[model samples]
Structure formats: C-alpha cells, structure tokens
Target: MEQTIQKRLPVGGDSWVTVDVYGEPDTPGLVVVPGVMSDAHTWRHVAGSVDAWPSVVVVNRRGRAPSGALTNSYSLRTEIEDLGVVLDEFDSARTLFGWSYGGLITLLAANERPIPQVIAYEPVMRPFGRHALPDLKVAEGTADWDRCVEIVNRQISGFSAAHVDGLRADPHSWATLRRLSGPLYAELSALNAEPPPDLMAQQAEQADLIIGQRNRGTAPYGTSFDHVRQHVVHAEVHELPGQGHLAHIQAPAELGHLLNNLAAI
Candidate 1:
C-alpha cells in the first residue's frame, strides 16, 4: 500500500472539503465520488488495481470526519457544487466515476456542464425515488446509527441479514458504518423531494454505466437502471456477473480492472 495524500480544498461556499489521493501526483487520473455511507478509502483498492490510474482522488463528501457537516440546508445540489470544485482541481483527469448516490451526483453534475467522460455504477435514480423510510428516521432521531445502517443496507441496498451481522462484528468497519450512516438518512430524505432523473440526458458525453448482474431486479438499483437508460440516452450499460450492489467491496480488483479498461476505451 502507498501513502495517501490529504488535500483540503474550499468548496460549497464557506466550507472546506477533504479528499484522499492515491497513486503518484503527476499521474492524476479520475475523480471518484463514493456512494451513501462511504468515504474515500472505500474505493482505494479499486484505485490501486488500475494500471494506468496513477492518481485517484476520492472526495470524503460531506458529513464525514475531517469534512464539513451536512448543513441544515443540505441536498443533492450541495453535493453537485462540491463535486464541481473537486473536478476543477483535476481537469487533466477528465474522467469521473461515481457509485450509487455519488453516481447520481456525477450524472447530475455532467448535465449541468460538459464532461468528456462520465461513468456511474448503479446510480440511484429510481423513478419516484421519493419513497419514505420512516423506520430509518426513527433510528436516526434516537442516534441509533448501527440500526440506521442496518435499515439502509437491508432495505435500500438489499443486503441480507447475515451480511449486515458480519459488518457489525467488525469494530473498525462497524464504526465507520455508524459514522457514515448519519448522512445517508438526510440524503435519502432530500432525494425524496427532488425530481426524478427523467431528463438527465442533457450531458454525460461518453456515459458508461455499469451494474452488477445480481442487482438486475433489485429495488432502487433495478428501477435506477431504467431511469438512467431512459434519460441518459448515450449511456452504455454493462453488467458485472455474479455480483450485486456491493461489487466494489466484494470484488474490487475485478470491478477496478473493468473500470480501468473502460477508461481507455
């Protein structure tokens, strides 16, 4: 493993954003945006697997440690503006990759401006994505983040109970999960109020979309693919066999290799 460089940049008005940089400084590659309940390190393995991807900058996003809070007025638009700042720092890379909620952010950002290459893995652009998860809200109010993460993974991401239990068994992973889950509750609620991605095809010049084969008909992801293909007309969708929503975690090397190759195409 190589040393990760930390960069704090000004973004979203008065707030400062933090990002983790992997690979060489001269080899600035893609700007990575992580999904809900995740941070930059979550994608480091994927970044390391790519041969040509010398530098991968993974934004911590908001509401995580060493970063700004999920302000009272936070919404998806806040994330898009934050991404815009990170993108400006890596214009040389020109490539953007996002997973889940972050995927939605990249796609939305591209529509706002021109981006040469945009790739999203299961961007959660579900039709009428406004479905409410009241139980998650109750858990959040009581500061029961473990329960919050369990609710999200099981309900929204469709994770099995055993899988959730396995995560709980690991102290480090469990702690991170608890910390990250806080923002997700707010983001999902905010998503409910936003319009569907019915007209997000205005940009993403070379849109490359990937989804795990196992997630083909799963909630959020299944309908999300339909929304992406329906609107992001130029998007080329690919399926990762024997994998589901958590391919990056379950199969980082394989997923990263595929994405690395896609970057060259």
Candidate 2:
C-alpha cells in the first residue's frame, strides 16, 4: 500500500506526469494504462491485488489527472510517444494491461516496441459499424459537462434520482474525469471519418488481445482473433463470457488471475 507521486522529466519537451511505483521493486514490472477520461487511480483495485509484483506503473496520459498540457494532436502517434516516455523510465520490458481507449494506446505502443507482453480489454475499434460518424458527432455535440451528467442520469434512469445524485456526488470519480482533454470528444467524433484499419493491422501483429464475449462495441468481440491468429504467431486471446466493457471493474478477480498467469508466461 505504499504510495508516492513523481513527475516524469519532459519527454520531447512535454512533461509526462505519472504516479509512483507500487509493490515490490524486485518483482516483474506491470504497467496499467487507463482509458480516456481516466487516470492511474482507476487501476487501484487491480494494482492492489497484484502488489506481489516487483513493480507497477499506473500511467496518467497527457492531459489527464496527475499529467499536464493537452496536445492539440490527439493522434495515435502522439499517444504512442507518451507511452514510450513511460517505457523509457522502466528498466525492463514489462507487461502492459490497458482498458477501453487505453487498449488502443497499448496496441500502438506494442506495435512500436515489441514489448514482451500485453493484455488489452475491450478496446474501442474505430468505425464501430452502426455507431458511425454522424452518431459520434451527435454524441460529441451533446457531451457538454452538464449534458454528460444528463446522459449518465438518463442511462441510469432506473435508479432513483437521489441515487444518481449520490453517484455524481462522488468527488474522486468526477475529479478524475474532469481532467480529460476536451479534444477527446472531438477525436472520438472523427472516428468514422477514418477507421483505424492500419492500427488494427499493426495491433494484430503485436500484443495479445483479451476480449469480453458480451462486449457490444466491437464486431463479434472475437472477430479480430481470426484475423490476427496467423500474423501474431504468439499472440493469445481470451474470452470472458457474460462480461462487457467494464469487465475489469466488474470482475477484477478474474481479470487479475488472467494477468497474473500471463505474467508468468
């Protein structure tokens, strides 16, 4: 449970902010990359469970909490560079676990560095079929902070209004989200304009992809496996039944077990 925060020296003139190392220093290094609008704290439960590991780095992407300065360029290349800065700080090739948008970042980084191992959970594939460009625009245009609150409230409409209020009242979660780069919404909006087929192909050549069977964002949830099976040669895929996008949060024990075993491999 030892906690420390340190600011990374500037990478390419941009400071990369991150949290301190967690767990034993001699254990295998494990890096957790959080999703868009999320920070290192989102991995608290997962990191705590794996504290037996020699080292763990929970990264806060640029423009996110514990980090500073939003880059106008929200391209995957920029994200990959950010990851490179973090990887440079580590002594050994490490296992990376990324969720949602963070999964995309992980994929790009693995493609660039050939890291020993990677575990990505339900990454958002660009050009999400039915949820295309126009839909993204609408979602973006309506995503003002106040509107975001409304959307969350409506999505959780079944809950009593008071309960929804309580959820929003949770300062930590909201604080973490507030640090998200405003351009992220725009970047997401531009998804349909350009599908990441190139990036997908790159990912297929690197890192193992972990998919949740019930995840609705990606086609088949298992489709990429078939495409990547031959190309990656050593990549592994795991499917968790009855699970969705938030599987890491909903099934931390199972996810942790999977990652722990992968680290051994």
Candidate 3:
C-alpha cells in the first residue's frame, strides 16, 4: 500500500477544498464522492480495497470540517463545481463513484460536464411513496444536534431505534453523525427545493447502478434510473446482499470489488 497524500484545489469564491489521494499517478483516476454527513475519510476503506489500487481521489465536500468551511453561497451548483475541481486535478480519464446524496451529485455533474464514467449507488429520488422529505424546517427549529441526528437516522435513513441507541453509545460514532447536522440539513433543503439539471443524451454510456438487496432505498434508485435510462446507453444494476443504503461503508470489500470492476470497463 502506498502512503495517501492530501491535495487541495481552488474553486470559485476563493474557497479551497481538499482530497485524499492514493495509489500511483499513472493509474486510472477514480474519484469517490461521499453522501451527506460524510467526508473523504468515509471512503477510505473502499479506496483501500481496490485491487492493485488505482489513483483514487476521495473528496471532502463543503461543510466537512476536514476540508473547508461552509459558505453562505452554498448550493447544488457549488457542490457540482467542487467535485469538478477535484476531477480536473487528475490527468487521466475520471471515473466517479458516488453514494446516496453523492450519487445525486454525480448524476447532476455528469449531465453538466460529462465525465468518462459514473457509478451511482441509490441516488436520491423523491423517496419511495408518501413519506415526507426530511424537513429542513424541523432541523432549523431544533437546536439539539443529537435530536436532529436521530430524526435523519430514523426518518430518512430508516434506521431502527436500537441502531440509533448503539450509535449514541459510541462517542465517536455519535459525533460523526451529529457534527455535520447543519450541512446535512442544507443538503436536504436543496433536495426538496431544487431539481438537478436534466440529461440531454447518454452522457455516461457504461454507467453502473449498484444497490443493496435488502435496502429500502432501492425504490428511489429504481425511480432515478427509470428517469435517466434514456440518457444512459448502458446501465447495469447490481445488488449487494445483506447491505442497506450505506453499503459502501458497511461492505467496503464487496462494494470496492464492484467499483473496481466498473473502473476496469
């Protein structure tokens, strides 16, 4: 294994963001985009699990404490540009793997600025049925970070009470979930209020859609794929057994296998 190095790139507004680079510079470029409440560290395992590990760039989106400060001008466009900057840092074909909210970002960014390829896991679509979107108003009204974290874990992620309790018991785990409540809320707000740009053609001809077999989040992914199928010439859907929405974190080895295989295409 090679030592991972940190790199920074300047986006608009004079704000600098960061990425953790791994593998050799000559290999194919793989950029990992994390979902809400996550940073570059969240993808550490997946990046490490890659076979012979290619050049991987794990990005820390805005509001992640390790990368940069959350600015007042935050929006989906800014986030898209942030990922684009990281891709520009590398000099090879950029293959993107995004999970959950990051999946949404990947699809949206590909539409605006087509990348070599994109693999999305459960991109956010208007939930399954009638469940309301995570209420930004509720998050705004509540000052208690713990409570806010609970709401998202349960209502949005569909985690059980026991899972929430276990998360709370671990100080590090609880802090990871609670630390970015503001950014998570902001992301939810954008999801509710805005729709991403539409795809014109098959921007990603060889895209892969990986989801968990038992994950309830699969429905939204299906909906998302249905909408984008016409614009995607070759989209294959695969499922990871015994995993859920956070499969990338829960089953890094298997997820990494799938991702690495996609990169080989």
| Candidate with maximal TM-score | 1
Write one digit per residue (lDDT tens) for candidate 3, span 1-265. Answer: 3436887777777677888888875677778888887778878888888763468878888778666765777777788888878777775746877887787778777776666788888766432222433454566567567877887777766678999999899998888878867576667666555544445214755577776777533445445545544444467777777776776678888888877777776
Give the TM-score (vs. native) of candidate 1: 0.91
Top lDDT hit: 1
User: What is the alpha-carbon lDDT of model 3 when measured against the actual structure?
Assistant: 0.71
Measured against the true structure, the TM-scores of the candidates, in listed sequence, are: 0.91, 0.73, 0.87
Per model, how many backbone clashes are there? 0, 2, 0
lDDT of 2 by residue, 126-186 (tens): 5332233344345557665544443333331123568556656888655444435344554
* Superior candidate under TM-score, 1 versus 3: 1
Better of 1 and 2 by TM-score: 1
Question: Native-vs-model 2 lDDT?
Answer: 0.59
| Superposition error at 188 for model 3 (Å) | 1.0
Residue ranges of candidate 1 with Cα displaced over 4 Å: 1-4, 26-28, 126-132
Q: Which residue ranges in model 2 land beyond 4 Å of their true spot?
A: 1-5, 12-15, 24-27, 129-143, 149-183, 186-206, 216-234
Task: Summing lDDT over every window of 10 consecutive residues in candidate 2, give the lowest-scoring window.
Answer: 150-159
Off by over 4 Å in 3: 1-3, 126-142, 198-201, 216-233
Question: Model 3, 43: alpha-carbon shift in Å?
Answer: 1.2
Q: List per-prediction Cα lDDT, in the order shown.
A: 0.79, 0.59, 0.71
